[model samples]
Target chain A: MASTTLQGLPASPGIAVGRCWTVDRRRLRTPRRKVTEQEVETELDRLDVAIDLSVQQLDGVRAKFQASDGAEHLAIIDVHRAMLRDPSLVDEVRRLVRVERVNVEWAVKRAVRKIKGAFDADDEFFRERRSDVDYVGERIVKNLMGQGSDAAEMPPPGSIVVARDLSPADTALFFHDRRVAALVTDAGGVTSHTAIVARALEIPAVVGTGKASTSAERGDWLVVDGSHGLVVLNPSAAERAEYEAARVRQMEREAELTRLKDLPAETVDGVRLRMVGNIEFGEEVPGLLSHGGEGVGLYRTEFLFMGRSELPTEEDHYRDYRALLDAMGGRPVTVRTFDLGGDKLPSGQKDHSENPALGLRAVRYCLRHPDLFYAQLRAAVRAAAHGNLRIMFPMVSGVAEVRAAKWALAEAFEQVVAQGLPARMPPVGVMVELPSAAVVADRIAREVDFLSIGTNDLIQYAIGVDRQNMDVAYLYRPLHLAVLRMLKSVAEAARAAGISVSMCGEMAGEPLYTLVLLGLGLDELSMNGPSIPEVKRVIRGASAREGRELLDRILDLNTADDIEREVRAEMARRFPGLLEGGARVGPVSG
Target chain B: MGRLERSFVIVNSLGLHARPAAMVVQASNRFRCEIQFEKDGLQINAKSIMGVLTLAAARGASVLVICEGDDAEQAMAAIGKVFESGFGER
Candidate 1:
């Protein structure tokens, strides 16, 4: 059996046994500089045809919104429309066609290749704009006579796709092709659009498999366990059988959790924990509520600034903000102010720094750009009157930044009040992502009404490991004794200060840490929308008091290895072998 | 007019992701040069990261750079120095 270790984006759970089919870039046409006036005219005709067909396809996708998950994906049509009319691309293609007298295919490719070079020189927003340029080239090619955007990726029935990297267009192709079981890419992480689509499709996916093509292949015999991010490339027959059995067991377990979807996330011991969603887009609120979320723990506001030209207008913010509250049926929606730091900067403000992950972001960004911050704060307050409102400050390095953010919130509240609006101010809190906040949790928790542990960022900062860095990626242990100890200390401090403690990161949603988080005295757990029902099921079945014992025992453990084994053993005893290979330990039956 | 020259590897270790590429592109914006990079058989506009990564010059590989900007010689010298050291160890 050929065995290799690769990094990838794991989007789904369970393993699949499959064969390898290697598709390299050899099929791609290389540029040939050596053609006729007839070829140029033919290529131009193809471009025009591609433009027409793309317009029709865009309309088709727009009209079929109900068939899909309905997130206004047709917005690409506007981008394509702009590209179709771009004089630069058209002129360049014409120039290439005239110079080389190449066929339409070569002409279209030449123009695209040239533009890609120029576009890369542009800024982030323009970089994103390059995606539009790609569509333009794609349409030109298709019009010239070809298939859709996917480049020769048609898997037979019950097949898996493996690639070096997957563009968003590749994701669209997956939706187009029905036989694809799952896909693994050599690149991209949790935030990639491909991961989002895989989750939406409910298909098993593993991405960020470093050098994915080196190990897994389009037709490689393998089993992929996307849940824990494992891919056994070219498994033996016995391994395939084992993985198949494991998959069946997982499906059965997932079905059990689906049954619990209707059940509330209450303990048999009669403790009620408000399950919340850490949502990115306003569109996600519907699914969050459907999954029995009581509130939104972390409604990340950065998504609004992602694909825009400048600061989103107050009206745009208000419209979406109002929609979220209404979607949750007045459930509490916590809106964190824009966390535009070094890494997550909007295309306009381009805050490039040496180490952006530790640079100006979240609260610091708001303090610097107070006017933009105040507008969002004002809209969030207005949305507050409609639902349970909570303002969360992200990436707070110290108490002073917290104080500054609070001042901005108060000033925005004052403005709304001055405009003859009834003052419905939301409680303010800070995301305890930095170690300084944990060190001084007593003081910060005292100042804030609540503390939501952003364990993702917290773990990253605490261990000084960029979670994105695969080399040190293993050190990003949320269950590390220091992390757990910090969580415990912060939770204790928050409780002592009469404030609620919660977690709203990947760690919070994970089943292994669910009991520990609860036992650590957290009042809430916020996770992905789809993770809600299963986590809730775990809560409803277990004894929270017993969970506290497990948490306490695991908390003081010196090493993470010691704590993990203990927690797993405790979960195993409670679950009676229902928990397998750390399929997350809480309520394994569910 | 003298032109500046330099060769820098795409850093933040993401291989020409949106931000780092933008920084490199933005850096080139200041200089008025037809900066060029050659690795393997691919030769492309150095100012464009798309061209750079499409060439697939992985970490530690030496890329010969040429520039004809306002600071063409300076840019060439500066970028040449950067490439020699893999852009401060990339």
Candidate 2:
């Protein structure tokens, strides 16, 4: 049979070959109708019953996951349950039924649309939230139409599930079934809830394919190359043979990575490197350990302040830090202070900037709120007694901010000491994210104990591109000469000052950049927990001398494409099959 | 009828989203008063999720809760507690 391929955004990395199973969500549609004044009471009653049914369905789903101990999944169900019982939604539908004399279905749809319209802001976080609201509306609508949850139609085992979009609830059902080979959706980005759950479940997934459901037929032999976002339908003999070979290679690579987990992260030339994990939630510790993470390089403290109504007290910060430190088992943990504002602005903060990316955020926010900063510092000082705890400040532009931060930290140390709490002064570091910090790195490095380069922000800021904005996302080039120069300069400054230097960014996680980073003289590389083994394999394969030679040759290149091509060729030649459709090298802005 | 009101800033990173909005509605329903939430000059029924969500109150956005009825004071206080505790998110 002739092979046809569909391209999409790679939401999760892996490959799966199975029969296609298209989940028909057409049953969720509700019919529109008009209601008379006398029918208002009946419409309201219908709305109530639909809501009750939706809630009951969600409760049952939650119960199924309750035994699996997946807190994140249960939390998502709770949110859906809350939405079902939301009085504002219920009252709005009832009012619409009476005032507009509309059917319960139309009223519910209108109410949900109104809420979604409000959430259609420029912020990515809020935009992503609209999906949850839409999901709840669909659930209620489905229930109102006397349709059961779509989980009833279980796809055959090892089938690739295709859908227009899969909600968290739907993803949870698939997760429990444990028979889904992969997921392909017509809608959803890499950050979607479906993608996140798919990654957690380790299922191969390709999302945002606009027409994956319509183009592919059910029961077709499909090959989902999730790493490359390619789906081959009715693959020919040659295509199947190629995919089979690729699958075997991928499995062998994975097994090799697992075997290297217990081995030390060192270059072939005997240069030992520290590979740490960047953690936002404490729950990721076990995964970090399994990935052979040496320690926590970047523990974002903003999460504690996030999803809460008030500032976290000193005790709150201390308890979280202490728990994390204890879990690391004496390995050094560097915790960055609340790098709030910008995209991560806490609810209720006024966004006064036309461009928040360049506005007062991170260190600036902390400087303005000294009391809040001091509370976190006091906690870190107290938590230092638990294990090796290091405090770092994010988005520091110059030495003044570092000194001011140090002054605040000293005050916190004194306050903690006065209270007779077990406190100790830990080493303080600054994230060299801004070009200003990188340029003046020598002066800043002199003021701090260490420097951790945040390449994600550094690349975006230096290139003047918002990585999340797809139109201009291609301009966010990590291999841009300016970026490389800034990184090199920062590493040199850290070396000159005899201070430790590390990079905790998305770049550090990609195997394509591992050699270049080491060659550039970065002392440590911290990334997401899952990427450790693959990166370690690269480290273990190449000598630092070869990396330095490759870096020198690539530094003379003018364009990002040239640099990328050179790096890819060298990596492929040295480590065969390592870069074989595995590492996504270019246009990776986010 | 007596009227009582209080202002609160959403502290949760997600602001008056689904779960918190539900808490606000649940708290408002406990009293006989008619409760309304006002944000950015937009007023909405505190007991209505659709209404509260339409305000799109983000973290650090201020919201005013007003209750008018015999149980206005109690309703206002109960709503205040929900915001104060961050709907148990903190």
The candidates' DockQ values read 0.02, 0.33
* Candidate that would win on lDDT: 2
Chain A TM per prediction: 0.62, 0.67
Docking quality tier of model 2: acceptable
DockQ of 2: 0.33
Error at A575, model 1, angstroms = 3.6
lDDT per residue as tens, model 1, A24-64:
42234434544566556766676667767766765554454
Which 10 consecutive positions of candidate 2 chain A have the poorest summed lDDT?
A581-590
Per-candidate TM-score against the hidden true structure: 0.57, 0.69
lDDT of 2 at A223: 83
lDDT of 2 by residue, A1-590 (tens): 67778889898888888889998766445678889888889888888888888888887777666444445456566666766777656777888889998899888889888777776557654666677777888888877887755556788899999999887778778778688999999988887777777777778899988898998889998888888888888887667677767777778767877788789989989989898999987778988988899999999987877655567778778767877887889999999998888656765676677887887798899889887888899899999977899999999989888899899999989998998988899999999999999999999989999999999999998998988999999999999999999999999999999999999989999998888987987889999988999899899988899888988998899999999999989888888866765633221111
Each model's total of backbone clashes: 52, 18
Q: Interface RMSD for every prediction, one decimal?
A: 13.9, 5.3
